[model samples]
Target: MISINNLSYYIGDRPLYDDASLFIGPKDRIGLIGLNGTGKSTLLKMITGEDQPTAGEINMSNDTTIGFLNQDLLSYLTDDSILHVAMQAFAETMKIQKQIDEVLHEMETNYRDELVDKLAKLQERFETNDGYTMQAKAEEILEGIGFSTQDLQRPLKEFSGGWRMRVMLAKLLLEKPSLLMLDEPTNHLDLPSIQWLENYLQSYDGACIIVSHDRRFLNASINKIVEVSAYQLNMYAGNYDFYLEEKELRNEIQQNAFENQQQKIRQAERFVERFKAKASKAKQAQSRAKMLDKMERIEAVADEAAAVDFKFKFKVKSGRHVVKMENISKSYGDLNILSHANAHIERGDKIAFIGANGKGKSTALRIVAETESFQGTLQKGHNVTTAFYAQHQLEALNIQNEILEELKQAGSGKTDQELRGVLGCFLFTDDEVFKKIKVLSGGEKSRVALAKTLITESNFLMLDEPTNHLDMMSVSILVQALQQFEGTFLLVSHDRDFISKVANKIWWIEDHEIKEYPGTYEEWEWWYNREQEKKKSSPQPQNSEKKEKAKVAVEKPRHDDTQKQLEKEIAQLEGKIEALESEVTKLETELSKPEVFGDAAKMEKTTNRYQSKKAELETLNATWEQLVEKIG
Candidate 1:
């Protein structure tokens, strides 16, 4: 629906995109990806006509409607409820409805031809667009994004900045434009809200382009990745994971080709140098020299993986217990953020804290880190040390100083050389380290903050939105480092795949409640789905059928004999399965302990027996659940 030809844009002397041509077709779901300052958002602005390209032309179909959600702007209005602002997208339809009402009133008063004709046209248009269901559809979109029905009646000014953004998102979805553009849509969403958005985008018929740092969200919502690098746009098919693999494979191929060409050039130059002054071999020398001149030098492709390397080294050992929170309750005036929350953290535990934007995830983290005061018993284990990286902590940096100076200040005991080396790992190379921190972009500041955090010797790390501005490669490096680290972590992140890969347990906060689920994200999702289906299919009493049977002359059996027998069998099987699973968990935990590996033969025998039993129990449980679901 939109096309760009030979597009080129620049900020001052720095070129953002040059000779970049792209075509966005109908139903295209694209994930825009690039390094920091690579113009991903700038490109979006150009596409939406908010900014014009330095050169080249953009052609969009005249009939197509495009809706863009501005990441930096929030709707401001007086005396307008959140629902009223969101419903403004359908203002034309509402106007038509009002006109129809007036026409109907006029028709009742007088049999006028003009009013009758106008009413017919208005009714036809309304029915064509399914206007009668507009309010219901709008409500569904709002609720899916986590806005309560009661909150809809509250004024827009009552909602916070994040909630207002959700209101804008709901309005965009309700409009159902031909093309949709979203920048970091998951930034303000909780796990459930993100899941709802995934489902909505997956089923949406129009084209969409989203720029998000969340790998899991991109994988779930987008089918194609459009990467902006080296002042050009590169397209890749499939999701973010596929893009990563494909980009690496392509880089390897390019590196090999460049190496081969360089080898040939070196050989030619060697021959030329060897025979330069020989009279007999003068012609051969000159011929080789000319060949070298004609040879097309292959410029070495950039090492895509060298952007950043996060390697955390811990010098302090954590105690057996990392932290403990008892009866923690936080409130602001009349609103309670958290209520009677209790949690315990242990060494080497990678726990993810998940919740909505205002659901006290960050507040809990602050209380644990001792950065904020709370009314509760917050205990830190002996020998426990923490490195806290808050989202807005970078603002505390002295922007007037150079990046290297900022790092040196934050690094404490680290020497200048040590700090420079750390900065290099985060992509500050050569004289780039001397650049002023004030001139750095958002992503650069984030990287600098992270680099400083790495220099610390804390045994426990509290990272909030650490991957917010990081590219895919940077995120991978951080994830790898975290996976290899021995320290405990309490992370608040919206990246589902990152959490799935790193976290062993989830500390989910919802509805003023905190619960821990021991599993990967995929397993948690499976369990949640099972619970939802159970709730939806809970058995209801058949009162009408029971009444009819009560009036019968002959009395039937109290219950179905076959059903009772099946229920007894299923219960026994389930009990056995539950015991087997508990045993399996215990065995797995034991196997993971260092002491158990001292006896290799015994460990192997125990694992083998456990696996056999686990497989049998899994099959039996599956069969039992299938039978139960069928009968229930």
Candidate 2:
């Protein structure tokens, strides 16, 4: 177990964490979450000893080993072979191997008993460390992280930034630390690589703490949620879904408690005011005033992020057949990426392009977007206006322009106020709209690009990993927007949840072939998992008297009870939201009072409560809508 005792970190006037304490167990699968600047990374750094806390300490077992996968892997990377970098994890074993090499060289020069004995000792150590098997392990991890055999031999410098991040991940996974901390580990992974990682981490015995914006990744891998905000750490004993539910419950309870306390405070103040002026009740009023002054007030809750309300409106209509391709083939030199791949996209078709890395998912998307030339009978319907959003679209934004200016340049044709409102819909408000794009974070830039896309009315959207760099809240909003998009879209994303919500068809790529699965992403996933189960458990059990065997490999049907439960929860959420709306109004009214201005601390608490309540309401509304959507 790792114990954090009253841990605190302060940078100048900013208190990232204050008096935070928690215990992490050996088998804990924790998802660390919060707003962008709420010290999630800082806390990880403190835990890993990369940075020191301003006060208190972290205590752990002496045998504990930590491995942290940073978001910026390129900073620490070298121009080494991918396989070589992975093998660096076995530092001790490599040292022993070097010693053995030196001893062997000495023996070749002078055959001495001492040299022979030294070599024998080194060899024994190497065998003890399982040095002989490390090469295979390195290669295995590299392959799991999406490096092809040929690619593993290539120098890290030859890969792009995303691929380099994968190489770094391979190194960290190979380390096999007792405690693993990953910051956005899936940010650069393909769908297959992500599934591979999910399988690996599901069976990982070490304590894992990850900070990622991927909601599906959190739900699949984490069993605990650690929320860092308002200079405090809050622990939730569940996954991301549970965390969302539990957080709302917590805020609701907190709001109730605050309301009760405020009620009592108001009563006491009234009593003090009415009696303090009368001589007969002056002594009692004094006692009441003192009691009121000494009361411990409940601090207001802090929101995770401001709400972003936006959606994409498909401005133009397209013909029935949106895109058609026949005998489509793409290759680089002698390497065939797409061998006569055939596919058809109809209007309103939501397609998810899934495949192993470098297996032509993006290539196919590029082909459809007409950004890459390929030998094929490709055709587009008449008046099939298109908009393409690349995975790295945010990187292509003009950083010199301000957020609002970018919107204007996109020809949104909205007034200044209208543009500000639209920007607010993506969590950009106030002075934030005037901020230069160069200074924005990756998430912010992605939101800007999305906002730009929203202003464009295109019937066909070729979006490649549109959710990249977005926070869970932003992702939820984007998913909602895409769900409402009345246009055909082809998406390339490793985010299973997002894909499941947005895509209605699956175009799987493998060996340069396009296998179209006719159904929603959820159906295709079920079919795929069922087949995988069958493949893993091939042989059927023998039956007596030639009895028929059960079809255990089939996907289990979702129980109707789950749907009923969701409905029940949805109804309950409506009630909670209504109650919360009332509470928010009360808080807002209190904050509006002129007397509140005199008490800066009270004003701050009230503002925080309002923000948190508002955020909770938005989340509840979103969840309720999603449940309703599933119901239909």
Candidate 3:
């Protein structure tokens, strides 16, 4: 058990906590939730000894090991494949394996009794550590967190910023610390990855604390909720939904008690005032006054922060057909992400683009917004004012500007008063509104992007993963505002809760086509569940040889004279790939050295080469596979 006894922390003049206490037991899956800048990360850091508490101590068992993922450090520096990092989680075990190898080598020549006894002890330790299955465990976890077999081999630098974080998360999970802490773990994950993480944490034997705005994830994974607000920490015994219920009840009790106390204080004051002036009751009045001074004050209800009411009314209502795409095809070189995808989005349609990450949910939105050029007849209806918020829109913000300045560019027509009002609604208070945009946290940045979307006042809002970093309250505010929004929106989100609330229509993007389904998220999910059940009940042949033959028949490739030439070239390419892979591995080892971090230019060059080689290797592998298929 981890006991946080009267913990207190301060940030400059601001006190984050006066005296906060929490008891974290094994199997305590706690959701650490709060608004932006409420010391959620700081609290975790204090517990992990990454940051010291201003006062009080965190008591824990001596044997406890902590595993933590820092939200601020999303970018990872490594030349090796993601698998290498995941494998590092078993660093102690890997070191043991190395020791075992050295022992075996020594045993080959030295037959001394002492050496044999040493080998036996080492062998026992190896089995105890489960060293044999470490590789399999690491691989299984990496796959579960969305790493493809090919992706596992690709250099860490080859992946985008989001994927790098996924690699980090995979490593942490593999570590299986006694206390697992993650801050906004679902921020960069897609739907399937988030689902996998929830399942992983649900079965996790150790105490887990996750700071996330992903409500569905919290509700599903956690059995407890701890709300940090107003320099106070409140614990609830159930999930997020239960927390809400308990919070409301607690608020009512506090409010009523506060009112009653106020009335008592008022009566006491009146009695003191009336008697203190009189000659006979002067001592009694003084006694009452002293009693009042020593009295404990009852706290009022938890003041809910002013929510951002995003009421974006379009300047002009678009035509009936807001967007029309006829056989729209998007390709990155030879990789056809979307091919002949046709869709017609009607005005006021709140559509959700749902699919796996690579299925082009964002691509379809970009096509609708006409931000990307595609090979198709993509038409916009009359007077369509479009605003697009990409997945990396927060990254594109001009960080030099203050929050107010940034919002000024967004809601150009609004007066300063109205602008401040909007900022306040989004939970940006007096000094916070003047804060530099660059200094904002992930959740804060997402809020700014959402604010910008509202400020643009476009009839067509195409938001790609808008809720990626938003907290529960922020999402609720956005959802409420969007519910009242007069404009049409196409949202690409993995959040089932967010989609279910705002999306009036569903655009299930699968393979290379858009399947427009007219239904709420609940209805679609019901149908999907039934479909899955149907597949489970369906019969299948047990003949292994027959199954293999059928699979080969379905995937067999044609061959000709061109295939013969390609096969010869394929052999040459394979040799080049092997050589390149060896060179890359050597470079990766060199890059991991501590001195490389000191040299910015050298790091940049190595990183560039690392990414480039990965890309080239990927291209070669794809070409080689094509050749092999043709030859077969």
The true-versus-predicted C-alpha distance at residue 446 of model 3, in Å, is 2.5
- In order, how many clashes per candidate? 0, 0, 1
State the lDDT of candidate 3 residue by residue for 254-356, as single tens digits: 8999999999999989999999989899999999999899999998876785565546666788888888888889999977877888888888899988866
RMSD of 3: 11.5
Candidates in order have lDDT scores of 0.80, 0.81, 0.81
Q: Which stretches of candidate 3 lie over 4 Å from their true place?
A: 103-121, 305-310, 540-632
Give one digit per residue, the lDDT tens place, for model 1 in 1-632.
89989999989989999999999999899999987779988988998888999999889999889888876757555578878888888999888888999888888879788878889999999867657756756765788789988888898888777788889999998887899999878876777789878877886768999988888889989999999988888999999899989989888888899999989888988888999899888899899999988887776888667533445566668789999888888888887877888899999899998766678888888888898888879889988988999768789778999998887786457777777777877778789999998998877888888877767878898999888767766677677767877789999988888888899988877666578888777788788789877854563243234223332312333377776666667657656765776677677666544344223345455656667878987797677657555445
**TM-score, one value per model:** 0.79, 0.80, 0.82
Better of 1 and 2 by TM-score: 2
Q: How displaced is residue 567 in candidate 3, in Å?
A: 36
Model 2: which ten-residue window has the lowest total lDDT? 545-554
Off by over 4 Å in 1: 75-78, 101-113, 271-291, 307-316, 332-337, 371-373, 540-632
Which is the better candidate, 1 or 2, if ranked by lDDT?
2
True lDDT of residue 430, candidate 1 = 88
Clashing pairs in 2: none
User: Candidate 2: global Cα-lDDT?
Assistant: 0.81
Clashing residue pairs found in predicted model 1: none
